[model samples]
Target: MIIDWQHHMSPRKVYEGRGGQGGVVIRDGKVTIHLKKEVYQVEKHLEFMAGAGIDACVISSSPISVDQCRMCNEYYHELGSQYPDKFFYLTPCLPLNEGAFDILDQGINEYGYKGVIISPQNAGEMLDSRRLWPFYEKMSAYNLPIFIHVSGHVLGYDAYDADYNLNIAFTREADIALNTLRLILGGVLTAFPDLTFVISHLGGGISSTLERIERYIDVRGEKFWTDCGGTPPFGAPYRENFRRLFDTLYFDMAGFEGGMNAVKCALTTIEPNRILFGTDYPYNFHTDGKDVARYIQDIRGLDLARDEINGMLGGNAATILG
Candidate 1:
C-alpha cells in the first residue's frame, strides 16, 4: 500500500481568514502563504492520489491558533470519516499552550487521529524545554508517533528577516536539523526511548551534516557536556549512542519536488526502513497529478532491492503508523 505520509491540508476559510490573527505573522504586512482555491477540496486531493496510484495520505495542518488547531482537527476528522480509505490525519498541536493536552486528547479519543504534528519551536519554547517533558511523557505513554514539522516558525536571527529567506533559503532546514539535534543532545531521546519521531524534508538535509555532528560528539567525549553545560545521558562513546538514537528516528521524502539529489544524500545516513514516501502535495505537487506518479517512479528507479523500494514507498509507513 502506498502512503503519502506528509500531505498537508487546511480549510479554505481558515486559510484565507487567518493572517496575523493566530500565530501566523504577516511579514511586512504581507501574507506568505496565499490560500489556493482548491486547498479545501478533498475530492481534488483524492483525484491526485488516484492518478498517482497512491492508496492513502496522512493529512495535517499548520494552524495559526489553538482554536484554529481544534477547528482543523475537527475538519480532518470529518474528512477522515467521510473517506476512510483515502485519509488519515495528524492532530495539529501547540505545546505549552493552554488546553494543549485537552486538544490532543480530543483528537485521539474523540476523533481517532493516528498521530500528532509538533513544530520545532512553539512560542519561543524549544523542544528540549523541561515543561515539554510531561507532554512528551504523555505521548510516549499513548504510543502516538510525533511528526516534527516546521510550522512557519523561522530562525530568530535578523539575517533571515528579508526576502522570505527562512522559507526560501537553507535557514528552515537548519532549524529542523538543529532542533532534532537538540532533542538528542538535550536528553529527550534518552529520556523517552520508546517514542517514535518522523521528521519531514529528510530531516532538513541532515545527511549532509551528520558526519560533522557525529564527529563533534566523538571528539568532545565528556567535555562536550561540560562546555555545553548539560549532563551527559550516557557514558563515553557519545557518538555511538547518538547514531543509535538517530537510527531510531524516521524521515520522509518530501519538499524536494521529486528530485533524486536529496534522496541520495539522505540514503547516505538514513536507512530504508527509516524512510517514508511523501509528496508535499498541493504545495509542491499542486499543478500536475502526473508529477506525483513521476516522483514515485523516481524512487522506484533507484538502484536498490525490491524490498527497499517497497519499504521506502509505503511499507515502512504502514509498519510505523500501525
Candidate 2:
C-alpha cells in the first residue's frame, strides 16, 4: 500500500473562482501558486494516483488563509468520506490564532482528519515559540503528526530579483532547513518527545548539511549558545545529540521531481524508513501520472532492501499516522 504523503488538494470552485486559470496569486499577490483542475477534480486526481501506482495520498492545500482553513478541511473531509481508500487529508490552522485549538479539535474529533499541516514559520513566528507550546502539547497528546511545509516564501533576503527563481532556488528550501533546526535547537523536540513531525522536501535538502550542523554542536559544546549571543531558550532544553533528535522526525521525498541524486544524498543521512514517498503533484512536472511511476521505479532501483523500499513507500507513514 503506497501512500504519497505530500499530495495537494483544493476545492475546484473555490480555486477557479479565485481567478486562477492554471494558477493563482493570492494574499494580495504576496504568494502565487500554479493550480490545475487536477488539484481539485476528484476523478482526475484519482486517475493520476492509479497511473502512478499510488494506493493513497495524504492531501493538503498549497497555501490559504487561516480564515478559510475550516472550510477547506470540511471539503477535504467530504472527499475522504466519499473515497476513504484514495484520500486522507491534513487539516491546516495557525497555532497563534485565537480558538486555534478548537479548530484543531474539530478537525480531529468531528472531521476525522488524519493529521495537521502547518507552515514552518507563521507570520514570522517560529515553531518553537513558547506560545506554540500549547499547540505542540495538544498535538502530542492527540498523538497525531504535524506536517511542516514551507509557506509564503519568507526567506530573509532583501534585494534578490525574480520571485519565481528565488523561491525554487533559495527561498522555500532554506526555510524548511532553518525551521527544522529551530525545532531542534529551540528545544521543541525535547519538550514534546512524543510528537511526530513529517517535514517536506527531504527537509529542504537536509542530507547535504546535516553533518555540518551537527559538527557545530560537537566542536562548540555548551558555548554554541553564547556564540549565538543567547542562553538556551527558557523552558526548552535540547538534547546533546542533535542527530538523534533529528532522526526522530520524518522526511518526504518530493520537490526534487524524481531525481536520484537528491534521493541518494538524503539516504546518506536519513534512514530509508524515515523517508516517505511524496510527489509534489500538479505543481511540478510530475503532473503526468507516468512521471510519478518512473519516480517510484527509480526508488525501487536503489540499493536498499525490499523491506526498506516498502517502508519508504508507505509502511513507515502508516506507523506514524496510526
Candidate 3:
C-alpha cells in the first residue's frame, strides 16, 4: 500500500470561489483565471486515493494559516477515525508563530499526530533562520520530523493579479530546493543533527545541482547552511552532513516527475534503501493508476529483489516516520 504523505485538500471557498489549479492560464507571463465550481471534494479525493491503493496520507493545507492548519488537522483526524488504519497525518504546523508551537504540541499529544508538516510556499520565513531556533528546539525535543513541501503560498508577494491564480503555480520545487540547500549549508542540519527533514518534489532542483553544490563545498571548504553561528565556516565540515540521506534527509515520492525520479535514484544512489512511497494525492491522477502500475511492474522487472520493493513501499516509511 502507498502512503500519500503530501496530499492537499482545498476548502470549498478556495476551491469554488477561485480558479482552482485547473483555471491557471499563463500567456507571455500574463495570468488569467476562469473559476470552476469545486471539481473535487474530500469525498472524491479519498475515493480516488483509495482506488489507487493508497492506505494512508498526511494531509496538508494548500493555503496555510494557524487556524487553517488547525481545521485541516482536525478534519484529517476525523477522516482517520472514519477510515481507521487507512489514514494518518503529518500535522500541519504554524511554526513561524510562537503560539503555533503550542498548538502543534497540543495537536500531537491530544490528537496523536505522528509528525508536523511545514509548507515552504506559504511559510514566509525559513525556520532554519536563527529567529526560529526556539521552535526548532522544541520540535527536536519531541523527536518530530519536519515535513516541508513547497506549495503556492506566497504571502504579500503579489505575483498574480486580482485572483490569486496570477502565479502559474506554487510550490516550485526549485525554490524549496534552494531553501533546503540553504538550510543545510546555513547550519540548521548541523545544529539539529538529529532533526528529521523530509523534502517533497524530489528535493526540487538540488538533484540537478548536485555537482555544483559539491564544487561549492570543495571551494568554500564548508557547508553552506550551518547553525554554528559566528558568521562562517570553522573547520572541516562533517561527512555526516554531506552524507545526510542515510542519516536524516528523506525524500517523499510526492510528485509525478519527482516521485518517479526519487524512487529511481534511491534504488541506484543509496542502493537498497532510502526510498519512501508517497502519492501526492488530492491532485487527481490524469489517466489512472493502471499505467503507473504497469510502469512499476516494468521497473520491478529489471531484476531487483522483492525485498527492495517491499522496503520501498512500507519499510522505508516505517523507518522515516518513526
lDDT of 3 by residue, 2-95 (tens): 5666666645545533435565534334352323333336666556554555566666654345666666666667776776766566677767
TM-score of each: 0.94, 0.92, 0.78
Give a tens-digit lDDT track for model 1, residues 6-95: 888888667666642333335443233444545677778888888888999889877767888888888887787688888888998887
Off by over 4 Å in 2: 24-31, 159-164, 232-240
lDDT of 2: 0.80
Residue 189, candidate 2: alpha-carbon lDDT: 88
Candidate 1 worst ten-residue window by lDDT: 20-29
TM-score of 2: 0.92
Model 1: residues with Cα > 4 Å off, grouped in runs = 19-25, 28-34
Error of 1 at 38 (Å): 2.6
Clashes of 2: 0
Between prediction 2 and prediction 3, the one with superior lDDT is: 2
lDDT of 3 at 159: 43
- Winning model by TM-score: 1
- Candidate lDDT scores, in order, read 0.83, 0.80, 0.59
lDDT of 3 at 295: 37
| TM-score quality measure for candidate 3 | 0.78
Per-residue lDDT over 159-201 for candidate 2, one digit per residue giving the tens place of the 0 to 100 score: 5445445655566788788889899888898789899999999
